[model samples]
Target: MKKWREYERLVSALTAEEYDKEYTVIPNARIKGFISQRKRQLDVLVEYRFNSDLNRRIIFDAKDRKRPVDIKEVEAFEGLMKDVGARRGFLICSNGYTKSALRRAQEHIVIKLLSSDQIDDISIGSWDMCRSDSCGDGLIMWDLTPGIIIDGTVYIQATGKCDSCGKFHIWCWSCGNRICIDYESELQCSCKGPWFWLTSIEPDCDEIGEQYESHYLILVLGNGNYHIMDRRPI
Candidate 1:
């Protein structure tokens, strides 16, 4: 599929730009698995240095399909991550993913489930102060302005980790309803809005150099758990 190859290239370009020159980003990489001792084809591969000069690898797989990625594919990706011995793996889909796949991703902390619609050139700004009572001076790192539609209502979302405590913060750009969580958890606005899941991938490169975050918005559906909609990044 030529279209799928183009989509994978776009994903590789976006990921490479995210890290800039700090890391080595390779497109269409074939890596040898430790356990299988076989070369596995990856859509994108990232190599970076961790603390104490330890080298770490990150892999990305782009899925282009008419329907959302299912739970079985997510499980296979997890196995690939382990086989490749990557510190983190990003599974980016053109459509979205099912609710069961999202739940499966939560079980593994290293697997990042993402929706690759388009790469946005968002300006990084402090949208609001941290809500943590203990850390009053800390600010939310980046402001994501894309609005997610739910139940015929458009709600702008802003989510980032606190600078001091590293707690994940989710906020509504319209009503200022926000909440802080320990990690990527489903959130509901106090304004009685619908529940939604926000997935973020922040590579552990803060100490070594620059760090970038990739976020995905998953819309909760009332029909069934077989399908879930993800916001298209603008």
Candidate 2:
């Protein structure tokens, strides 16, 4: 379980540079434009921007397997690397790899295997490397300026009016979830899952614009997750 949490941080580490540079990459999701047309799910998908668009890509996959990885797995990953046409690929694992697996991975230099001990070698441009070194520190108090609420429970939220884009940003700290609003008043989770009681009628665009939207009503979704949406009316 901790490994998965760490894996998520690693995904953040892998994509943080692109994010800081204002390039977008999908996380914990499979990319669609690749060769197999959805053959695999990438933990981190880094897109390189050029000419004001994403033109090239790099990828990373974290395998938290209980047993040591095998050469067959490495071979499969190599094939995927070729199929995706990724500029570089890294396979970070919880356990070590087999000798044959290591040799097989090297046969395809694009894909390299990293044992648990080597994770510290990962280079992150912006996030303090020491922050991610601790799962609790890396996850619990993200510096995203989430609004915290306390009642029968403690929650986090980002619900309010957006000034420039002019939309509602919402969040729930207790559930550790938030909303990502785009054009119009339409909103969805970063996971892009169905909006389950995800939106409220009261906040109406006007209420958000007025900054009078009720916080308690907006923090907790029907699914019991926190929704953090930025409400800056510029």
Candidate 3:
């Protein structure tokens, strides 16, 4: 399993009825890539489309870790949403937020901090009616299975140590460039430039089929069906 799949699983376990009555969960909802003036690629752009009666959209960026989400990250997400013409945005992380980050988040956008326990609460199936886009039929479905697809790219900060070189490397799957920790180590590849086809799964859908959750970080590649490139717990 890839880290991204685990993110999906974690989100799949949330209870859908307690949240907004008209929140619909869409995993990996595509945000137009070319809209940005600088043309920056975004990771994990999930869309929460409200009921048809309410004409509004909520966007989210999920990070599966215990570290404090920095302001720069929030700024980047905000930029992406603004570029795509979205009015509201959220940053979801497995851990919590820093006091400074939380304060900063409140100043600009609607940010929600979720812990593993809260995530469990939503998964307990003890909420009200889910008003997301997919709840109209009264049939809710929770998606826990991992499904990998191609044609998606990711930008990752190098966090793991290389066994062969005994050094840290930052690899950007979107650009296919691997750099050293200090931005000094430069390794060039001749095969496919710096880009690598990464594989990851979309978040899981709640039983109500109203919301989707993020569980892990993943990379997507190719055009056909995709597969996980790294093994991690889900």
Candidate 4:
């Protein structure tokens, strides 16, 4: 597992280097499954806005096996793609793929197979500063994805745990705006548009029937201001 972790790290670094600007590349992303309504752990999830009304989501899975990946593995991954409603999926393998696997991947338009050779060397460095005012110069590891739309514009947002203070650091990727929820709970865009924070609680049960909270942030733009609402299940 340690070796696999290293391989995944390499893929994540390369992916972030290539797609961080235009797309939100999240490593070790945990997303809820639309079908099962359960949390599914993904190796990486890439999110972007195709247009004003459409959001495109892509998933990446890394396999580090000695032998080539076979058709069964490809099929299993395809199921995951459907469960998550991903537009497309990339399966990165260290040892390549079997002929059957290649054929199966070809059969599915959403599936793409890649060898580790496809990813080049990348230097993973800290990109943004933590928004925490007290935690000066604290670096925030961003996992930005598509957030609320405001006035015909889609805003990319990320919230990372501050390394210095262990507080949530929020940021806007499009305009270099940053805020720390520990010190401040309000969010505003770079356009000087104020964003209101709202919360909603929803009750939910896990796969084992254990109750949990579901959280979502809804952003609405009107009257030259933006409203952000969070749905948290209790």
For model 2, how does the per-residue alpha-carbon lDDT over 85-201 read when each residue is reduced to its tens digit? 565666766777788877777733333445556556763333321122212332221224333444445343433322112233345343555443333343445554323323333
lDDT of each residue in 49-162, candidate 4, tens digit only: 121111356778888778778889889898888877776788888777877788888644333444555534433355456665677644444555456676677666665544
Q: Residue 158 error for model 2, in Å?
A: 13
Give the best candidate by lDDT. 1
Backbone collision tally, model 1: 0
CA RMSD for every model?
Answer: 17.5, 14.6, 17.7, 7.8
Q: How accurate is candidate 3 locally (lDDT)?
A: 0.40
TM-score against truth, every candidate? 0.46, 0.44, 0.41, 0.55
- All candidates' lDDT scores? 0.57, 0.45, 0.40, 0.57
Clash statistics: count for each candidate = 0, 23, 28, 2
Order of the predicted models by lDDT, top scorer first: 1, 4, 2, 3
lDDT of 3 by residue, 52-143 (tens): 21114445666777687877777777777766545566677777667666666764466566666665444423212222232331212322
Error of 1 at 157 (Å): 39
Q: On residues 1-234, what C-alpha lDDT tens digit does candidate 1 reach at each position?
A: 256655665666667568734354555666556568777788777764122111356788888777888889888998988876666778888677888888887644233434443523332232457787887555554435356666688777765545445455667676777776544456666766555554443333334453333223344544433112221110
List runs of model 3 lying over 4 Å from the truth: 1-3, 12-23, 37-55, 117-234
Q: Which stretches of candidate 2 lie over 4 Å from their true place?
A: 1-6, 14-25, 50-56, 107-179, 183-234
Error of 1 at 183 (Å): 44
Cα deviation at 217, candidate 4, in Å, is: 8.1
